[model samples]
Target: MAQRLPSAAVLVLHGGRETGAVPPPPGPLNLPGVRMLPFVRAVRRAAGAPDGDVLVRRVRYAHRGWNGGRADPLHDAVTALDALREEAGDVPVVLLGHSMGARAALRAAGHPLVRGVVGLAPWCPPGDPVTQLAGRDVVLLHGNRDRTTSPQATQSLTARARRAGARTCMVTVRGGDHAMIRRAPAWHRLTAGLVAGLLGTRSLPGPVDEALRLPPTAEATLGTLDLDRLGARPHGGPAPAGRR
Candidate 1:
């Protein structure tokens, strides 16, 4: 029998200082530690996203230049998203972004395919403004002790998003840092709860409950090639099958 696709699609945007550049390190050393995959996986599981139905697409913006002056990464992200939507055909999509990526995701919320957006430690871009997010379900998540982006900045952005007429929710991870959700269990729980709510799942009583409900053995199978190992090779070039 053919596999059934998920009803919802997710586009994950990774945060970075440089536009259209490689994503920065995620964990302590700042490596690309599944930036938003874990959260996406958790949400999918909680919401019981059908196999093959739920697709996770990651978009990395190109680095414009040293001055950070260039066409908005959001525009580039939106274009990529448009292609994904065309391929999926009628599936509702959730846009998730971290740091600078969050800002880009917000800017792209007006896209016809987007149903909602989740912004983690989002960074506000100069002149981009939050008005573009009006009428969308926007969730702003941040760590209270985040030194990199600062909670104040997130609050300011959230307020602006709300003013723009977006249905907004702000979640502040207590005693958390820039990478708090990745480090502490408490922060992770908070982040998971927020994501679950956005995905419209019944809230798990706690992190333990959430863990217990996850599939005992689940693995992510890449299409035919492992993009990570292949790096910048052309998409259709000859490549090893199923090996990253």
Candidate 2:
């Protein structure tokens, strides 16, 4: 029987530490990678691929760290994107990444098949490249009280990405912390909506759409992506949009 391919793909990436450790084969262990499993499950359930197609996959890293300039996760993510083309046949892909994973996704967003990226508590440091994000849609969700990753860094990256010509915005999770255990469902829902929307399974979320409509570096609060009735929404706004 011939293999089935979904119309789109989402590469889910988990967080890692700043230091290097040659990784063993990717499997469940450690807090960073393990913490991302829930979000992955949410994406699988909501990614909207028909007939149980594989719409989402996790990126397996060569090392658990950014490894400074080596960027093992970034390399791994690029390899995955290449392999995905072989598996899915040129389908548009959205990257759903957290912390260090988000950092790698943004760095690897230059891949030809990448149409969008959703960064969860991204760890984009000063001087990280923004040039690659041009023409791609970018969404970053950061918890205001996250001590592990700076929410301000995410906002900074969003601004830089916008200036680089990517449609980009950062949504602050009001009471959310680095682990996202606070208001977890809201984060999962918003991330999933952003992923599916970017894949064209549904229309773009409201805030993201609004941000896209604005000129580069334009500042504005987007309501459409968070257009749901979830109580955890910023200011208790409406629930999310783009449900499957």
Candidate 3:
């Protein structure tokens, strides 16, 4: 078969509930709390994205969560990425996912075509692989007020990725929750900026506020510790052995 020429592609993955069942498709309006629609639109309309140059696609999961079972979210992500590569040729892909989807994007970052990954409130537990993402640009955004997935998980994951030689950065949203509905504007700005930066379309705004750079008040109190002691584990297969 004739191969499609390479072009840029942005793959969006959405966070799932703990049900382990398929999620309803996102509505067209991109409403608040809609799995991943808001984020997908944010990136698509980001500043500096050239028309006809970038393709944004969202992954539909067959089941919720990364339970390490057959046809799980992670499995669906891989399948989506594989199809994307086939259709787009050897194009550079920027992955953006939230929560469980974020975890799946991080796990899938090892792919050669993946240029960068943007994880929003990712559920990155200890022991996830960082070596696979060596030398790749990785950005993580988490809300300080998030209870569903702690920002510490992303912090640990970022520390490990740094150790593994991946260029990594983490941003914390003040008073933002798991859904980021509280600081919706901030969430959209950060996500859009990260996507633009990752795709090399434009650089992220600098001279940011101190609060955005630091984690939540409570987590910040516990001075930095050794990440190696955090039980960093890398799964041998497509997904993590345990669910968050």
Candidate 4:
């Protein structure tokens, strides 16, 4: 019921094959679950954002892989992003993608509408160029134990992006695998935190807010709202010695 300034948009892209879209004749069951909806919902709920302040779009690719010639996932994503930009009217857009989609998001990060990118277990091959990501804030989260797409690939990608003048950080998900099914909570927490930080929205409930230890840019509203009761010292408050 309130109007917020500096509106933002989030585009969520899912992994390949396992999360690809169905044919023209579709039903409700056709929804993408492999990684798309879950991530979008988590970030949306965490932000608790009202309409017009933050908008989210779940991208359904034309094909499963980025290599699909005419049906390339990247092309579909770019078209979706263009539509999103037109709808939001120049609002800052944050791209959130997993696996193959993650790689595509990184490639499209150079779009003027995009300000930040969050890649979950992205499939970034060693030789993947990073020039397209220049000037964008990038965060890559990969399961150290991921066999589907080596964590090393994301590490190398981060390194190259940083070298290309992008503010980049790669977070290793300890003992987790590519899907991150076991440590889903932590994965979602980090994703939601990043979304809140970029969109200037409220952080979700529970200990995750304090656990994230997000910067003021992300936690300012949370701090003012006293949402971080688990860690009162986060808002420039006095901390008693020996307090845990």
Best by the lDDT measure: 2
What TM-score would candidate 4 get against the native?
0.74
Per-residue lDDT over 194-233 for candidate 1, one digit per residue giving the tens place of the 0 to 100 score: 4444444433223212222223232111111111222222
> Candidate 4's residue-wise lDDT over 1-244, tens digit each?
7444447788888776534354322334444344456677877876554454678777866665565334366777789889876665788888998887788888888888888788888988777678988777777777878989877778676666766766566666677788878678777876777666545454323343242333423322222211123242211222223421
In TM-score terms, which candidate is top? Answer: 2
Give the per-residue Cα lDDT of candidate 4 at 33: 42
Q: Rank the candidate models, highest lDDT first.
A: 2, 3, 4, 1
Consecutive 10-residue window with the lowest summed lDDT within model 1: 218-227
Deviation from native of the Cα of residue 126 in model 4, angstroms: 1.7
TM-score for all models, in order of appearance: 0.68, 0.87, 0.76, 0.74
Tell how far residue 198 is off in model 3, in angstroms. 0.8
Task: Tell me how candidate 4 scores on lDDT.
Answer: 0.66
Q: By descending TM-score, how would the candidates be arranged?
A: 2, 3, 4, 1
Candidate 1, residue 185: how far the Cα is off, in Å: 3.4
Total colliding residue pairs, candidate 3: 3
